[model samples]
Every structure is written in C-alpha cells, then in structure tokens.
Target: MNMCFVTHKVRKGDGQGRVNYEVILEALRQGHYVYIIASELSDELAQHERVIWKKIAVEGWPTELLRNQIFAIRASLWLTILRNRIDLTIVNGFTAYVRSDINCIHFVHSAWLRSKYHPIVERKSLSSFYQYIYTRLNRSLERMAMKRTRTIVAVSEQVKHELKGDAHIEGNRIAVIRNGVDLEEFYPRHVDRRELHLSEQQLYAMFAGDLRSSRKNLDTVLKALVSVPEIHLLVLGNTKGSLYPQMAADLGLGERVQFLGYRTDMATWMSAADLFVFPSRYEPFALVLLEAMAVGLPVVASSNCGAVELLTNKAAIIINDPDDSDALADALLRCAADRRQLKQMGEEARRLACQHSWSAMAAQYLQLIQETALHKAVPLPES
Candidate 1:
C-alpha cells in the first residue's frame, strides 16, 4: 500500500513527532511505500528507499502562526500532485488542508479555546490576543479537516469527545489510539541524585512543563507545595521567561521548591522522585506523564489531562480541578504521608506503562490503517 504521513516532524526522541516516527516504521516494516510531507523528517526515513519525502520549507516565516498557515498551504498543494498515487493518507490534525483517510487528532484547538484556563480567556495582554487568533485559526481549519476525513484517530478519549462536540462529528467515525512511551529509555532506574544536583536525602515530588504558561498550572503547584511542607518540588523547564520561580518565592515556598531549569535527563529525574505532580489546566495527552509512570513513579494529575484517563485509581491520584490548590496539596500530601502506598502506586504505574510501549502503539496504528484502507472514504456530512 502507498501511504502518506503528514506532520511537522517524524523522529524518535520525544513528543507527538515520535508517535508518527513509530507508525511510519511499522508501515515500512510491513513493506509499504511511505510518502512523508512535512517541514522536517528523520534522516532514516528520508534515506529509506521506500519512503518519498516532500519537505515543505517554512523556515522563513516570521511567526509560528504564519509558519503553520504556509505549511498547510504548501502541503495541500503537494497532496494534489500525489493524490492519484496515494492509497491512504494519514494526517496529523490540520497539518494540511487536503481531505484525509486517517486524521490523527493530537490536540483540539477548539476545546482549548473554549476552556476558561486558556491564556486568551485568562489574560488580557497583546501576546494573549495573538494566541487567541492562532487558536481560532487552527480550530476552524481543524474542523474542516476533521469533518472531511473518513477515519479520525484520536490520541485520547478526551480528544474524541471534543471532536464529537466541537466539530459535531459522529462518534462512530472516530477511533481512540492512545500515544505510547519509550520504555527502555525511561523505566525503573537508579540515577545518582548527587550527580544530578538534586538533594540526596530530600523527599521531593517532580513537576515538568512550560513554566511560563499558566496552562501548566505551576502556580497552583507552588501554592499546593506551601501546604505540604514535608515534600519539595523539583521544577523542570526553562526559567528564562518563566515566572514560576518568582511565584514560588512569593508564595513562601522558596525552601520547598527547587527550580531546575530544563534538563535532557527527564527519565532519570522521574525515577528519582517519590511521585510526579502535573495538574495541567488542559492537555490533549502528555507524554511526560507516561514517561514518568514508565520510570515507576506514581502521578498526581488533574482530570483535564488525557493521560489520566489511561491510568487506574491505584496508579495515580487524580484531582478534579487543576486550579484548586487544596486538592493538589491534598494529593501531594497523600504521597508524603504514606511511602508504602506511594511505592505500591509506583509499581502499579510501572505495570500499566508496560502495556503501552511505543511498539504497541505503532502496531495499533498499522492495524487501523490497514483496516481503514479496506473501506471507501465516507466523510461526515457538515452539521
């Protein structure tokens, strides 16, 4: 079968790109000619005899908003030329404006735009206004792309529900294929804390995300840490533009919070921590949460996180509202108060993570693609 993968980057490392990378590998293994249309792709895929690379150069675009628009337009134009030659086109959301066979819904901009936690809704700054426009633009394009696609591959149940509600698409048209983690790179490990610059004896929980944004809810985490004095937070992410470090000090959590700017060794940190805390206001699906669990760490997450949907009650402590400091603090305290229970939760988390390796996810994608290709395209009618 001739298959086309449309996404920004398809490489094995981290994030959504890694998802595409794995699926492409599976397609190649099954002897499929993979056509990749994107701004960037892994060298391995580019050099493959069976893979046809259509690289869309959008490096000159001044803003990310402009870059996305340009990529969509260029990729759409290329799709027209490849239309006759293609059997199945698996796209990532609205990366291209062309109609697709399998549209992988990663993050629904429409759902985020509707959330009160959205930066545009919470902040009145000029930057926030620009973000609002960017989101709105993607939401409109995503709706069109989703409705026109025959098979929608939602990365999580949260995204599937939002697609049905936001785009008014039929539930039967969507299939949920949760993202996977790299088990070998992030399973139970013993990394020396002294070498990592973390306290050797301190009982600390971990939090990682874009600290500059309120969406990650670092503010709430800091507030929650104020109450749970016994446990500290090892903050990961760039501190250049982030206010969380200052916010931590302002909240009198200076002693309890250690802002360790972004590091490459996330798996090590997750393994070292007692538990992982990530009460993000909104997330389509967080790979970090999965990686943490793969490292045998119990998670304290909010209901808004799509990854939480994949977890059992014994594997994580799920808080209802991310903004509620009390709830987040209580969840953290639960870990601090009982080490034995926390250890058990971590083991459960590890067991669950074992079921969601990158290989498993890629296999699911290939199965869906093969099954989807057997049927004729039947796009949903506009609501």
Candidate 2:
C-alpha cells in the first residue's frame, strides 16, 4: 500500500519527526510506498528510500496564526499533486487538508492549546481571552480537518478525551495507539556501572528529557532528591532554558545532582544508572518512559502520564500525585534500598517494552487504515 505522512517538520532533533521517520521506514520495510509532506526537512534524511519530502512555507507566522491559517487545504492539495495512489494519509501534527479517497489517520501528540509545555503558549498561561478565541477557531479548523479524516490516533486516552470534549470528536472516531521505543537501540547491555564514577553498592537515579515548563515537575523531582541524599540523581537531556541547574544549586545538591544536558548517547546514560525517574505532572505519552523501560531500568513515574497505562504488574511504580515530594522521595528510596525488587521490576519493564514493538504497532496501524478505507461511508465526527 502507498502511505503519505504529513508532519510539522522532519529532523533528528525533533522527537515527533524521528518517530514518524521510524514508522515510515518500518512501513517501507514491509514493502509499502511511503511519502512525507512536512514544513521543514533535514539533509540527513533526504537520502532515505521510497520517501518523497515536500517542504512547505511555515516560518514567520506565530503558532496561533499558523493554527488558524487558511492555507491548510491548499497545502494538502499541493501534497496530493506530488503523489500517486495514496492508500493512507497519516497526519502527524495537524491536517493539511482532507482527502475523500485517502484513509487519513490523525495522530494527536498532546493538547497543543491546553498544554503548558507547548512552545507557543508559555507554561500554563493561556489567558481566558486567548483560550476563548483560539479554542473556538482551532476547534473549528481541527474539526473540519478531522471530520474528513478516516481515524484519529491518540497517543494517550487523556488526549482522546480532550479531543472529544474540546473538539466534539466522538470516542469511536479515536483510537489509542501509544508510541513505542526502539528496543535494539535502548536495551540493557552490561556496562561497568563504576565507569561513570560511583560505588557499586550506592544507589543512582536518572532523569532524561527536557526539564522545562511547569508540567515536567523538575522542581518536585529536585525537592525529592534532597529528601533522599543517599540516592544520587543525574539529569540528562537538554536544559536549553530550564531553571533546573539553579534549583539544584539552591537545594545544595550541587555535585550530587549532575546536569548532563542534551545527551545524544541516552542508551549509555540509561545503562549506567540503576533507576529512571520521571515525575511529570502531565504527559500524553513520555516517549522516554518507554525508552527507560526498554533499557531494563526500574521506572518511577507519575500516574498522570499516558504511558503509565502500558505498565502492568511489577513493571513500574506509579506515583499518583506528582506534587507530593514525599511520595516521589519514598519511591526513589524504595528502589535504592532494595536491589532484588529493583532488578525484578527492571526485568519486568524490559519484558513489557519488548512486547510493544514498532512492527506490532505498524500492523495495527495498517489494519486501522484498511478498515477506515473500507468503511468510508460512515460519519467521521461522532455525535
């Protein structure tokens, strides 16, 4: 089958783009023709086979302005002109236009408007007036785009509910298909834990990802770190503009809480650590969570995360209240103090992560596209 993907941009730095790249590559592996339509493209990915990239003009416009842009349909038409018979159209970020013959699948990563972590609206401060105007206009456009699409693939159930309530999309119109991790790149390998410089018996905790915005709850993670002194915390990932370092300094965890920003070698970092901590206040599906689990690390995450749904018995410990520093501290202490339980949980996490392979996910996606295409007569926006 021929599949076309519409994305905000295509780059190695962007997680969404990377995931789209992997998914499309997987489709190509299955002998399917894949094309991509994006706002931007990187030179690194230009050589990929069976991939057609059309870069559209999206610079200079504010996010809100782009959200309500009148060029979506025209952009979609432009993409359609470049392709042949497209059996499926996967809209990664937002829809360009609705094609009647195309089996369109819209993947909602997060509630862009409501999310505090979004780049457009600064942390949790969308004013009532802005909300009123954007929500109405955004919903109208999104609904129009979505109504013509075949299926809406939500990364989290929370996201599905948000789309339903805010955009009036029905439950039947949406399906929860969580993003997966590449086990081959992120599995446990025997690394001398002492190579990172630490005692073999000492407890080590690590947090990976951008420690920005109110939602990541890094403040609470830092506070929890102070409460458990014996367990050292290492934060990896780009803190390009976060206050994490300052908070660590103020809390007096200066050296104990090391900030290794923007690590390209995440697998090595994950291998060196004993425990992986992510106490986010809100997350659609923290892709890093799956990566941690893939590496056989005992994960301690907040219940608010959509990826938490994927964790079954003994796979991970879910801290329901992200604001509760004591709870976060306690979970960290438990993992640190008990080696046997940690190892067991880590193994279980790896097993679960292995079960959710990209091939399996791709198969499900193909099935959904086929079903949606066959049932085109059905109403798209549920009542």
Task: Name the TM-score of candidate 1.
Answer: 0.96
The residue-by-residue lDDT of candidate 2 on 106-140, one tens digit each, is: 33332555554443454244554555466556556
| Candidate 2 deviant stretches above 4 angstroms | 10-13, 40-45, 57-74, 80-85, 97-140, 377-383
Residue 276 error for model 2, in Å?
A: 1.1
Which portions of model 1 show Cα errors greater than 4 Å?
377-383
Tell me how candidate 2 scores on lDDT: 0.73
Cα-based TM-score, every candidate:
0.96, 0.84
Error of 1 at 220 (Å): 0.3
lDDT of 2 at 174: 83
lDDT of 1 by residue, 81-104 (tens): 999999999898898887888899
